[model samples]
Target: MKKVNYLDKFLLKVFILFVFFGSLYANDHPYIIVLGTAQDGGSPHAACKKDCCEELWDNRFLHKKVSSIAIVNPKDKKFWIIDATPDFPEQLDFLEKKTGFSLAGIFITHAHMGHYTGLLHLGREVMGSKNVPVFVMKKMKKFIESNGPWSQLVELKNIALKELSNEQFISLSTNLYIKPILVPHRDEFSETVGYQIKSKKSLIFIPDIDKWSKWSYDIRDVVQKNDYNLLDGTFYNINELPGRDMSKIPHPFIVETMELIEKDKNKVFFIHLNHTNPALKQNSLEHKNILKKGFNITKFGQKFHL
Candidate 1:
């Protein structure tokens, strides 16, 4: 190699940064990237002895992280996450690598262990991230403020809780905004919500919810309004859980959801699948049926420009 000058090195560094961030800020806009698609316990369900993990036991390659998505604004080198799942560490790493930005904030959907537990990783005991904005609804704000380790994260300012009203918009930039809509679900600790992220094209992210009939808003209306909808797909059917009162879990079955939708299935994507859901397997009939119906099941690392 030939000798390089001082200015050459500086320009090269700038070019490298621009190229890295360019992946996210393409066309002067950002994109929404999928991080994980599994339910609370993740795809393996730690205690599961079911055939779901029969071929995947101790197989990290076959595992799926809990459901989460990242909104990247490479122009600002900022990112916002929806739900900090148990796999936050891996998800964050993937997003950072894909977008070349640090996490600027987090927007939690609810208080489920799968949804908010990753906030603990950002607290004093772990990464110790500073002043990361965690947007939430009223009850969620109270729940975090009143809880133990989560409360400490607040006091230490590891994360800041920003209260949001239902249907209110949180503008991230000139082109980007997020709207939270309250949805009915098992609200043991805090209210559940689905978010509408609007940029070039709008997208709805609802990783978890009760049955479609239970929600006040029509699923049809939601799909009609947004460019893309990633709704809950916790189980393939009620029979997935052998003897348990499956009704207690409350998520809409994939088949039931497929039957419920009347619009373009391409606009609808099912996510937050439990480990027992055979639809996760590419070769499985359930997966083929989902595609046959024209709907999609989100896979880790799937990117949707918005």
Candidate 2:
């Protein structure tokens, strides 16, 4: 070996330190946790006098507001929320406790009340955040800009809207990317979308869809392409909601979804459950059957390392 000088030894030590820190930073992966799994109105919905709502009121059950998730990037100590549901305050508190107090951004999938209405909390009356970035679709961007309470948030500079394109990827870090996929749903105010979140491990989220068969796209194809699929499971059966017309409110029933995904084992996890759906109960027959069939019913506080 050649003789090493003091300057050469110093340079080698600095280079080694740089390489070690770089590897440590590169190895950190983002994590996600499901905060809620109910539909837009959520379990124990407003004006709902059903047994489910009663149970929640009496503290027998603790159903959350709606389906939403928290994505934590440990490397940056940043937290991202997907879908700002009515239960945002509680969700934020939960997130704050689980991960430190650092909210990076909020990604909205659509203009539905359950999905994006919680942006109100960021307004002057609440956190009064200065230019909190909100990632949304083009139409949703316009909708928020023109709407009343949402528009006020924009005018006050509480939230800065960032338009997202369908099927286009938004990179949060070298190891994490989120792509939005357009889905067919009630477009009374704005279009609907599902997200394909790619980390070292990818996960698909399709919270609300009109009907899988009616859509021009193939849901199965999307599931086959992703590592984990968190699909729409709004109802357990067609007649789940007693008084409502099942045809008007379209979603893939748990039974039908199970049948459709029977062949593809260990990939599907059903979410976005309605209050009427018995699958929400931990000990329910529906829940047991789903687990037995290699399907999972998404529960609040469930974490997935990505």
Name every residue pair that clashes in candidate 2. Answer: none
- Candidates in order have lDDT scores of 0.89, 0.86
User: Global lDDT for candidate 2?
Assistant: 0.86
The count of residue-pair clashes in candidate 1 stands at: 0
The count of backbone overlaps in candidate 2 is 0
Error of 2 at 37 (Å): 0.9
Model 1 clash pairs are none
lDDT of 1 by residue, 1-306 (tens): 335576788889999999988864575587888989998998778877878986687787988889999998877888899999899999999888877788889999999999999999998789988999999999999999998978999999999899999998889988899999998899999999999999889999988888888888889888888899999998999889888898787888999988888787799998999888989888999999999989999988898888
TM-score of each: 0.91, 0.89
Q: Model 2 TM-score?
A: 0.89
